[model samples]
Target: MIDPTLPLIDLHRHLDGSVRLETILDLGRQHNLPLPAMDLEGMRPYVQVTDPRPGVMAFITKFKWMVGSLVNYDACQRVAYENVEDARQEGIDYLELRFSPGFMAEPHSLDLQGVVEAVVDGVKKGTLDAGIDVNLIGILSRTYGPLAAQQELNALLHCRENITALDLAGDEANYPGELFVEHFQRARDASWQITVHAGEAAGPESVWQAIR
Candidate 1:
């Protein structure tokens, strides 16, 4: 599994989902948010998946603490910057970090547009500091339903030049790709590439819907 000559590219990593455990504990305490544990080892069981979860939704629950730690725009920026730094340390040549503004904003009621701006600024700084190439993909979290997804898309559109692609993620089985046809069309109109999280929690029909 050693390929020193070839470039290592990661196209499907989520910025919100890749937060370090130490940062989570630090942020939680900094904001006085209730954390299950004070130490890294104690925090692992709450944030990391030690055993197989019941289903995809159950697994998604683990992301609560990850995103929960993002209580403000500064925290959002820190996470994004750190993600690029992490990619560089992993010997990655390129990385695409995807995230949902609404999902990151909901728990703390942070401004959607502010979240996008912070991520863009953070990734830019990280790339410069780490000497790595990183692109951002804005995700429309479907679990929030079509209305909120629209808001999320609009916030992402505010920084269109900074984002390379548009993604649809969260609650695939309940929300489905069909609901986002127009959203992707808007993303295309803005000259953004489209990538959807399909068939992970749903069926082939979901994949077909994504393709269509």
Candidate 2:
């Protein structure tokens, strides 16, 4: 068997990734949002990661709907609160749920920071309700580059609490880590924890650069 004490860590488990389709359907009804007709057969490809598919486009699209349904405080609180209940069953303590505020923005110009704030509020609720130590991280998408990343950092600084880190993500094919050094450096200056997406798609060098 593989080493058991590898300290299983999940740097980036999308929140909506954990959401069941039934939940989406329920949310669709509650929020008066029309969800896309899911293709169950096509969805088979998405469940291949984390007990479900991690990189399926159809599954990915669901996050957009999830975001739409959860733009307000009540929805954010519910998701955050429920997440901890789910985490307890999984035995995943000290978890950090990294969210991409950039991608979660609403069509009505809902600032990226709004999404981060709502997510933090939800995370706080989850941690308190489950009596577990869970943390939230606002992941800045790499494709958006340093400017957008800095905005996320700035928002976190203004946020009251609940966030424990800021991460970089999005397609590894576009904009490698080196390009965002200055933003991360500024983050370091601000004393914010940092992480980046690497090794999942690109080479090991990508991981090295993200670390350095």
Candidate 3:
């Protein structure tokens, strides 16, 4: 039995952060990327947390491990493909995958644009392969400031068709929203949807500035 319509909407999610561990491990192995420093004790690794907050923190940290060794095209494709495949299994009909497409150059052989395109291509391919549709929304960490915002916005402008929106996340309490007003306006002017993470830990003011 299945309910065809329950009105499920996951408005905020982190793309690289949601990747499954086994998939990450497999890809890391294939790409020869070194994982984070987690000492293995008995059957479990010390950092393999599973108690809610710690679990989520440990989960997010895994991306650093996966990204550490990725230095070229094949690695990016592998990660994006694995992510979307997992999404399909969860009965996601419409999905928006968001990521901070930053500093994945050098060893990954990816320019920012290359990383964006690879993720988008992987989403499209995942739809056909997994029977679930996905759209990518590229993001920037506001703490990175307007210069990075402008670069992300410019990249979004160029890849407008693939990326559906622009978002600023990470460190909501310390960074001021007034700082990104200019870039957000630019993104708004360019017809990109803007959303930010606020009260998840802070207060209403963080979100207020974003929508303002």
RMSD vs true structure, all candidates:
0.9, 4.3, 3.8
Residue range 1-212, candidate 1, lDDT tens digits: 78699999998899998999989999998999898888999989887799989777888898999999999999999999999999999999999999999989988999999999999999999999999889899999999999899999999999999999999989988998888888999999999999898898998889888887
lDDT agreement with native, every candidate: 0.93, 0.64, 0.64
Candidate 2 local lDDT, 1-212, one digit each (tens): 96766544445566644655555555657666655544444333333243555553334554565566564555655666666667766766567777766666543356766766777777777777777677676677776776777776677666625566667776666677877788777667766788777876678999988777
Q: In candidate 3, which residue ranges exceed 4 Å CA deviation?
A: 1-9, 36-49, 52-62, 103-109
Q: After superposition, how far is residue 206 of candidate 1 from its true place, in Å?
A: 0.4
Candidate 3: global Cα-lDDT? 0.64
Any idea what lDDT model 2 has?
0.64
Q: How does residue 49 of candidate 3 score in lDDT?
A: 47
